[model samples]
Target chain A: MSEPVVDTTHEEGETRLSTGGLGRTLLVAAGVVFWGWLLLRWANDWLGGLFVPVGQPFVAPATIESLGASIPGLAGAFDALAFAVEYLPALSEGLWLTLVLTVLGIFFGFFIAVPLSVARVYGNLSKYVSLLYTELLRGTPLLAQLFVLYFGLNISGYVPGFLDGVFANNAAWAALVGFILNSAAYQSEYIRSALQSVDTGQLTAGRAIGLSKVDAIRYVVLPQGLRFAIPGWTNELIYLIKYSSLAAFITVPELFKRANDIASSNFRYTAMFTITAVLYLALVITASRMMNYVEDRTAIPGLGTGSGR
Target chain B: MSDNEHTYLLEVDRVSQSYGTEKVLRDISFEMDRGDVTVLVGPSGSGKSTMLRCVNRLTEIDSGNIYLDGERITGPDVDVNELRKEVGMVFQDFNLFAHLTARQNIMLGPRRVLGLDKEEAGKRADEHLEMVGLTPQADSYPGELSGGQQQRVGIARALAMEPKLMLFDEPTSALDPELIGEVLEVMRDLADRGMTMLVVTHEMSFAREVASEMLFLDGGKIVERGPPEQLFDRPEEDRTASFLRRITEMHS
Candidate 1:
């Protein structure tokens, strides 16, 4: 009976205890965390300041009537947001300015990036120049750069009226100045590394066919270099959106500034700021999708598919 | 054929090259006649590739004159691009533009350097692609093809310019064992058609079978130069004999 009871059904192998168990656990854990966060947000809104001992210093959040009433800081935010919304055209006009700034910044940054990349790679000039240029831009903060343009020109009385009038008045122009410098510094490295990745033999091959230095760059080297750089360049595009928020400080009304202005004008601080958060979410999500589309379009299939860099 | 007897197609007189402080080629001198497949055979670091690069002025020779068809290819005054068009090159890696198809790869040189119209370039590309037996693969990118096919595309790309000479720096060196024969066969076909070629390769069989004159380069200098039979089967110098012996022993 013992001999006949011997089992040979151990063929499923070890480590086959079901990986879905771990996945399901992780899924439940994530669901719990997400709902916990949503619950906290909901409880905070429905009941005033969730941690009040009574209706003493902080507003009582447990009462639904108190939740509808505007609290002090939020009351001002609500009023500011309401005022901001009634005049939609003014805020939308700022989009034109933002667009102008983005375009000009990209254009000028391209000019700066191309030459700097080439210089860093092949220029007979000292390492000091490249070092100096990179350090000078990166060492100084962008906000400081905007201030320097504004105040340096103002204090010295050295600026032409037309120049000051255009840049100082237009938040867009000042933003462009700051954005271009920032973009140029970073782009130089991205593009330089890309150019360097191209085999030295490509230059030799071009030379073997008799391409001039300019022609080699224009034809052989630049195309390959730029192809490798596309993904990094897409990253730079996304970064431009977030970093662009700083331009609002100089007075160019991009999405963030408009959102802030809306929240401040409305007494419904929670609702308005939530809408602002959603607007930012939408912008970033769209940018991410667009970048992915571009990457798929431009990348070399096998190499790019793996997301190596 | 005496070395001094004929007018040379390209001549390197006392040419030397070095990177930074280390010298690669020291006092190297050689000459090639028109329509000759002059094979340079040696172990790695012989600087044969560097020597070939100097002819096209692909690499600048530190101190010497490289006369290509009697014109100094190394000078600043001579249009370097013009020199390149006259002398095409095939790399070991077969550096075809990956974004482009085989036909596009071949056509690029003629279209860009020669200023040939798209039609003329296309015609020449087809002719060269046919010559390399890659007409069927003309529309395919370099990435899609096998190593052997890529090399054929490289050969076709080089030939498309209709250059006076083609420099092949280890064309078959990077190929898989099975793929080497197809590339060598293409080289042999090119030799049969009488292309003036300077081939830096280790394929002794290709050299023995196809070369008109074979130069045994060791340590950046030509140790011996003669017909393949004279060099391979009945070698003269100690180094050449030893090199040939090593090759034969390895094969066996």
Candidate 2:
């Protein structure tokens, strides 16, 4: 019985090790492909497309022919690679728009969130106002919100003249506005929890030191609470990066929209979308690493680690 | 504003407070003059902390009035912030801003409330940090410092405001046995410098040594009040005597 048990444990360990190895190998492959693609694009731009031609689907006919003749299985992989190389420029443009939408949405959302979270935590009757705003925005779908802003509001001429020149088109502005509102609602919830997690003694100590209610919050509570909110804010930012794709429905030519257009035209949805997915994954991984750096830099010695009182 | 000569730095008259149905402080009243070190000692939930909180208007009174520097502070019309500027408080938990260094915590009040420039505030902060014997830990965050050092920073933060009266809500109650002495030493030093302080604590030794007057509270009321020696050696009330005896035994 003991020998059988040992054999079973050995089998389980072997399976676990193989699976872990495979996952690590896949991750390394993804990183290499991402960096290689970035370097190729930069080199192509700097050298004026000496290696790979610009503004056309890059099909290296000689390389594909030779590889296919050697191994019939290599033909499909080469074709997919050609498709990705051809459409990456358009996809890169879309990715830039996606980055802008997510960054600005989160940035503006934060300003609104700070006041909303403060109102929710400290206001008298105004807390209910904040609650209503958060609930209305969070309770609905982001897609529906974009549709309402773009079709209902923008077409109806309700969008103000001040933002006319901010974007190339009205739909992008609508998407930006919708994202700001939706993101603010969610970010305020994170901030509210963060503010509440701070010790009440902090407020007492603040007031005791002759700080007015507002000053105490501005100086003491907010600085500490905002640090606690960093992890939550990072999560919101990642979610926003992915959710920016929803703006595609409203005709905003972001990353997902560009992918959809190219895939639909070529009828190679699987190949086109696989590369698109990789690009997004690369983006998200980069964002999370940056946020991790931010969290570490801003972290106090004992906070969130249960070391400080 | 006339320079009115008042006998007391702080005066609490017939102040009562309750949290919902449970009353924490009932008609509590006290008066402290300049250079006075008054300590309130009692069992837990007996309103010692509440009394200290009420002095600073941190806890609103259900009735009666509190006056600091001969100015009424309890009314709605009075500016609570300005009133608070004359009263500084230290807490049992230290409650130092975790994100800030010891020096920054001390500089906060002077720079924000007192409208002092950065250089002036920094100088004041260093002075208070040196006074608490924490000048070496000036750049350390509260989380990086030991409990005793953190409490000393808390003391320094309060002292930076240069308040007329200082309220301490069990400043050493949260410290470990080894750490408590260092905090008590800082408090003793403050008292020796003629700072008017009102403290709440169960440290009978500290109260006996440094307290000019002691009030024994039980069941939301003062059970005994007199000099520390009177309350400790010859309590007029059995409740005070028994509570003191029990607390002393526990500490020992």
lDDT of 1 at B147: 82
- List fnat, each candidate: 0.38, 0.64
What is the interface root-mean-square deviation of candidate 2? 15.2
Quote fnat for model 2. 0.64
Chain B alone, model 1: TM-score? Answer: 0.94
- For candidate 1, what is the DockQ-based docking class? acceptable
Lowest lDDT block of 10, candidate 1 chain B: B1-10
When summed lDDT is taken over every stretch of 10 residues in candidate 1 chain A, the lowest stretch is A1-10
Model 2 chain B, poorest ten-residue lDDT window?
Answer: B1-10
lDDT of 2 by residue, A41-136 (tens): 656654778566664334555565566667767877776566676788778768778889999999999999999999999998989999999999
Residue B136 displacement in candidate 1 (angstroms) = 2.4
- Taken over the whole model, the C-alpha lDDT of each candidate is 0.71, 0.83
Candidate 2 per-residue C-alpha lDDT over B93-148 given as tens digits, one digit per residue, 9 for 90 to 100 = 99998879889999988999999999999999999988888877788877678888
Q: What stretches of model 1 exceed 4 Å from their correct place?
A: A1-100, A126-131, A154-169, A267-270, A301-309, B1-6
Please give the distance, in angstroms, between residue B210's alpha carbon in candidate 1 and its true position after superposition.
1.0
lDDT of 1 by residue, A129-152 (tens): 875787788788877877675555
